[model samples]
Target: MEKCRASSRIVIIGAGVSGIAAATRLLQNNFHNVQILEAENRIGGRINTVYFGDNVIDLGAQWCHGKQQNCVYDMVKDMGILHETGDYYSPIKRVRSNKEVIPHELATKIHDIAVKSMPSGPHPVVGSFGTHLAQAYWRRIESELPELDRTVASESLNTFAKHESSIIGADNLFEVSVREHIEYHECDGDKLLHWGTKGYRRFLRLLMHVSEDSPEELGLLEGRVQLAKKVTKIELACPRKVILRCEDGDYFEADHVICTVSLGVLQEQHEKLFTPPLPAAKVNAIRGLTLGTVNKLYLEYGKQPLPDGWVGFFCLWLEQDLTELRKTEHSWVEGITGVHMITCQPRMLMAWVNGPHGRHMENLSDEKVLEGLQWLFRKFLTFEIPPPQRFVRSKWFSNPNFRGSWSHRPTKADERKTGPWDLESPVLGEDGHLGLLFAGEASSRNYFSTVHGALEAGYREADRLIGHYTSCSAKA
Candidate 1:
């Protein structure tokens, strides 16, 4: 604590979870001169909750992924925020073109088989996930399960792949990295919890600032945040200091700057964003790592009864040929993968949009989206459903601030041994002074694409600065 410098001016770019966490941690460590610059008017860069009809919907990040090792889960649980566990074990109905509900047990069995068949070993990232998946499936079909119907097995594989791709937020499995996918950090349990839009927003508020009425309120990180300050350029050519210029023509100077912008944004603006171009190593890492979109469409229907115990409406495109669907570029709705029926809020249905399809979905009007969904449900389900009273779409891909939802596994083209560590390395001045540090989910090696990963990244960078100042203060 003696190494703490209250006068050190630290500026954080982007008010996402990583940025917010970094700011809060700095303030906690007695770093008083800190400022947070946010591109959007509101906080929670990717963790957004929107309201529609009578219910609150999480348009952005929805789940804790795991309970035990997850930092986000621990904090929310301690706060006593209301959330329900996702029923992955719950029966997924495979709807036939003739409207037959395939037995739940059969569907679960297929799911289990698919999970067991995930390709293991050192797979090069050169080819897409789809290619690896096809090879893996063929091997499994021929060697392991020769007795199973080929068509049924293929459909099951497609369903599972589509779901997994949505989870990765990739445009297609082909865009995913097989190596990175294999290396991802897996948490303790399969348990997932969703904090309704309002609950999540409250959680964000708690993370960013202290409450006035609460005795524990520190209030150091709250008012320092400046919203809607889109940082266009970061000039770090100077040895001792760096300057950040915003889109709104405002300028801020700081001894150390922590950038928490999304990987998508960095991909789009890396060359122009930095005054001195980034190192080829950093550029290659950025190009090698991919950012994927996972948008959600919320619909409110008048109290409809879904399956008895099922929490989700899984749509298996049985009518469409999997090969043909994969080949076609115009088949955007094919990516309108599944709908999550909220058990807590009965009337709401959240449809998932992944990758390039998410951008395509954003182009269509609300009526068109509704029409497509209606047609899809009518073709699969036995029940004749009424039109949704209202609908909201999350256009994360198109949002300039976000560009995409989250980071995905790196492709083979990225030769760097460490996936995101290359990006996480600090940019230094001529004098070897730390001018900039990167903190975000994309920059995290073990926790990429998770909120906890982002939070940890924020803390990591804050600590880096603290350690530096501590050593300097001691020497002085």
Candidate 2:
């Protein structure tokens, strides 16, 4: 039996933020024998950015949700990376379903109110977020508020719901937790730092910096990362040693393995991937969590698409019945939970789709997707619109490497009442030796479903091993 060495053979599964963070931390702590096995050829798991001509299009993560307290923000900001500040309500250009052009001042005011006045406390009678929202709107309508106030309030609430639901990645609002509606890690000054051409992938390379040779020195990390290496199985009968098998017939042995694969993948392949099966708790944790889909539709055009210096388009169907519209099959635009025109990039427009609609939209041909967008434009805009020159889209749900975009508040019956701790807990063998470990945004209790959350989890898992092994070595 090969003895476990803290400095040798630490395998990290997945090349996402969590995996990369883990590998870097291990190296920092003098554990050089680390290997990163990424399924896809690319590095960043969900923080992917690509270019269309001169414009930068982020098909995955686009913003640092909270800047002041966010680690991602701290790193990027310190690096002097340039980005634009943004939010849900863009005043420069927008189109609502009611055909009303909302003034920038009014839009900002309404957005502020809606965010500050989010309904507090759990809804005992209303379990679903959709029902809760409906009830709240009806209650407001019954109030003595002025007609203008009511209109503004209605639009604000609807906009908030749609935007937040997109962030949650749940198609049906009812599926979202009424109690857990507010994200726990939401920091003060909820600033949205939009990454332009710099792209979020900059952070992956930033995090990989370990050697003192130069800022760009990632020779160790670059060599350790094996892209296109899909881990098929993990044989862990030996307490001090484990073996990993890849689809390409390559094999590797490691003393410890950190499984940073997304919760969605774990739920799908846990039974088949682990040898002798995981314990009931670990299996239950995987089952209990929910993985939601979020897709983006990127459309590019030649020259200035809209009015001179105008940003992007925003289609807020204020009067449309969202609940009924979601059930419709023909309205492909309806599948899009929200649409935003990139203010910084005038030639591109992006639409966000969540829930099952995300999957449906991704499966459609490029022509079909464009047709749906056109239908939306004709319905919402009063003026004639031109077709886009080129189009691309995201299929995070359909992609086996990432079954879903992010994690969401799981249904009560799906998860243990103790919360996401079990989901993040290290999967240990029956003999009480640590055999497998877990880390990801889903595993993070405070920062779940955020890029920083995933990074923090990776750092935490690495620190865990650092403390455990280093302390043991000292005693020995």
Candidate 3:
């Protein structure tokens, strides 16, 4: 029985966190015949860390998010590599598009009021989170502030909404399901835990059980992954084996196949990727869940350093200014709600954009993007900021491998009664055995759109196969 388990061929699609975690767990359980097929030339699907300026900066997954109940945090808590970040909202200056500085106290008050009015937990009523937030926010704004401050507060709330949209990977809160938003379980503890210069790729090393100081690879995973293997089809009609055909004219047969591709890729390729097509329920689940875009623009300042004690800029644009900008090509700059200094990289500033604007930014030329950034800075900042020495940006939306950033539960998801559970269901072969399995962050019920969620999902699928083999061994 042990020999049979060890000899069973297993193939995992994508070399992302979920795929890596699945392979790691399988190897630990004596499943030696495992291979990870990655479409890209490199590993770490969405956890991309690159060297920028003087130190390392994360282009993909940046923070650990929380410490409690977070597997990534628990694994590295004792390593002395993680640090708690300061309050993300406070100690920052708020500047309007007209170059007027909002009083710190007033900004804090508006932020507090807005946050307090948001739904804290799931409600019996079903609706869009955006609708609930806007209605509740306006009521508090009307009762708390004078007419003079009302206009600025309302504009500031728009900036806040943009920030929320980026966080949830949605174009706007109105598209997100209110029930799912409240149902998301946030791990209790520090909300933003920084990895410093080490970067999020450190978590991948931990999964492989590799030491940071060593230049060695784990024996189980060494040569186990095949890069640039874009799998185009999964033939599951075979009664005894599952066949995978890659775009490079290569093929592999496996007793079991686990797919860890992103929800975006699944949405784009699922129709033609599977043989005999996926189950109708699974297809419905894929259509119901949405993959949103959240992109980052990094500006490197080599000669001119940022102002002292500088944290970030929270931008507030008046209705008239926004209306005027919409006429110009730089209108996409309005999508940028804020820009902040990278905690570890002192010479770098990160700007965030999401939804339609994020996708638009991807299509523009580098010169155009830089010019837009200059225009944005000139309007909001009091100081004379020069163009960056170098600029780097993420193009997740334009990347063929990843159609968007991550997954989010949209309002349609509730109406359709479909979600991660349906997507994660295994497909049975003609022999009445599990042939195809799924694992990814989108498959996580409570931890969707997080690195920890991806890790957990991978472990879940690996454990499923392990349990099945264990049951068979016991029967023997």
How far out, in Å, is residue 337 in model 1? 1.9
Error of 2 at 400 (Å): 0.5
- Each model's lDDT: 0.77, 0.73, 0.88
TM-score, structure 3 vs. true: 0.97
Model 2: CA > 4 A from native: 1-6, 82-113, 121-128, 144-159, 210-219, 308-313, 316-329, 413-415
Q: Write the per-residue lDDT of candidate 1 for residues 1-476, one digit (tens) a residue.
A: 22247988899998888998899988888899999999999888898877666657677776777776787777767665646665643555676545666578777766766776665556554656777787777776777667777767776677778888888777677667777677677676544676654545665667756562465422556478899899999988655788999998999888889999999999999999997888787887788788888888888877754656656566666645434555754366677666667545678777787877778988888777788788767766777767888788888888988889989775544445447888899988777778899999999887899888899899999999989888888787
Reference-based TM-score, model 1: 0.90
lDDT of 3 by residue, 181-275 (tens): 88788998787898887888777887888888778754358889999999999989666578999999999999899999999999999999998
Candidate 2's residue-wise lDDT over 402-449, tens digit each?
A: 899998764552335534677778866656556677888888887788
Weakest 10 consecutive residues of candidate 3 by summed lDDT: 116-125
The global Cα lDDT (0 to 1) of model 2 is 0.73
Tell me each candidate's TM-score.
0.90, 0.88, 0.97
Model 2 TM-score is: 0.88
Residue pairs that clash (backbone atoms under 3 angstroms), model 1: 125-412, 171-355
- Count the clashes in each prediction: 2, 2, 0
